[model samples]
Target: MSQDLFKEINHAVLDLQGAQLQTYERPLKRLVSLLQHPDLETYNAELTEGLDLETFLEESARTGGSMVGSQRLLWPDSAEECLGLTFLLLQKMGEDPAYAATFAHDFYYSGSKIIAGIHSLTGQLIIPFIRDYKSYTQSKGSALVALQDVRSRKVFIVHGHDEGAREMVARFLEKIDFEPVILHEQANQGRTVIEKVEKHGDVGFAVVLLTPDDEGSVKGGNLQTRPRQNVLLELGYFIGRLSRDRVCTLKRGELEIPSDFAGVVWEDMDAAGGWKQSLARELNAAGYSIDWNVVMR
Candidate 1:
């Protein structure tokens, strides 16, 4: 039963994945039926009952700006939340067509969250949860389902010689509910530099601080400032590990910017405090829900 349901739901979700405006509703309606199924609600609740809604709702709740005010799609209770309010979105389309119509595509296809041309909907987030629920209910994936709703708030920060910049960024991230991972601050335990980064860097997002700590140029040419060598290396590394969209770069000092990489977002680490909102927008664009209130301050 679970296998059949998973297959059906996955197919419907795939149909919704890259669907165009004209073709979205059919698959979406199918999903509504699948989600509202009696067996599904029961099965999903039993398996997902253990995971807390708070962490799971962190990102989803941020999209409330697009939601129909009366709809309030987030139900703390299980079964509904597991689907990322996808079903409720349909309700919004009907109840408040004028408002919901604007962002309806977000409910079906998540093309905007693409990295290297790969699109994801809420962390692929729903599919994995369903898989975990199936596995856990079967008595096989107890550990996986137990931890699935625990959002990874860790963000990796790579910087060079700018303690002020690092501290400020870390504080801002903390304010917005992310644990910033700064390499030198971690316990060495005899591990090398790369080893430390590898160990403490299982983060979903990476913020690179490109502050000028060195200067160089072609052998005969006048030297131009540059970020430390390690900063560039780690920037490239995280872009590879986490994809370009997941990593953000903050430029400071006099260094020339790195070559533009697709999906990688960069912001001027400015002092007028605009960088906070800028960073917030980038993080939200990458699928993390950012609170404008906190960002505005």
Candidate 2:
């Protein structure tokens, strides 16, 4: 299946050359139209099956066509489909490094304007992929070593009054090459806690410790333990600053989460026995590129 797809992709590359020389606009427009067709989904699925998407994209970028040509290509009518097909082709090219490198070179140099135009029309998509791709390629050989630079990768630790739990989390973060930013430790003399948090807003990610620090009365007049008011505030702040995925909530005990924010996923720190593995997963999902093998060991 991959071989067949590779041949088709090679044919597309050949078509690109012919289209550039002869009737430029028509063939380019037709190719973009064909990519947007629903049938392309099958090809995309077939090509991506059992493939490591990030590695495929990285290899594709490092292989394939010449980096010199500049051709005016037609923008896909559907930006979503165009982006999807682009990713699929990159994955398909991964099966053949020679083809992948050739396609990658052409895509990067010649298709730059086409991608830019797609971004201009769609308003989002492609820029983030490009940034992540660049990061993936740059850290190719020494990912584990790169992760050890705490200064470059900072994780803000939001915790309640549970000193032990917070310390444990901080130590775990440090082991994974993350510089844990504790609010109290880094508080400025004149600034408020909120102000201090804002000061370190550039931190890539945050981990909120939801330890049972405070008791609250429920509708049935039963008292339940919950995180401190400040902890909740900081959690909300991080959620706003760095989306839900980038902010991980680690619950230590039977804590009652707020009704409004009940949908947020919380990992049980006690149940896990060790939080490092789960933390590593969160870091990778949040685009940190953590090599778990080194960190876990």
* Local distance difference test values of all predictions, in order: 0.62, 0.57
TM-score of 1: 0.60
Tens digits of lDDT, candidate 1, 72-180: 2244564434533433443343344333334433432333422211223323444454455455545632524433322356899999998999999999999998899
- Candidate number achieving the greatest TM-score relative to the actual structure: 1
> Which regions of candidate 2 are displaced past 4 Å?
1-152
| Residue pairs that clash (backbone atoms under 3 angstroms), model 1 | none
Worst 10 residues of 2 by lDDT: 142-151
Number of backbone clashes in candidate 1: 0
TM accuracy, model 2: 0.52
| TM-scores for all predictions | 0.60, 0.52
Candidate 1 has an lDDT of: 0.62
Candidate 1 error regions (>4 Å): 1-120, 123-150, 258-264
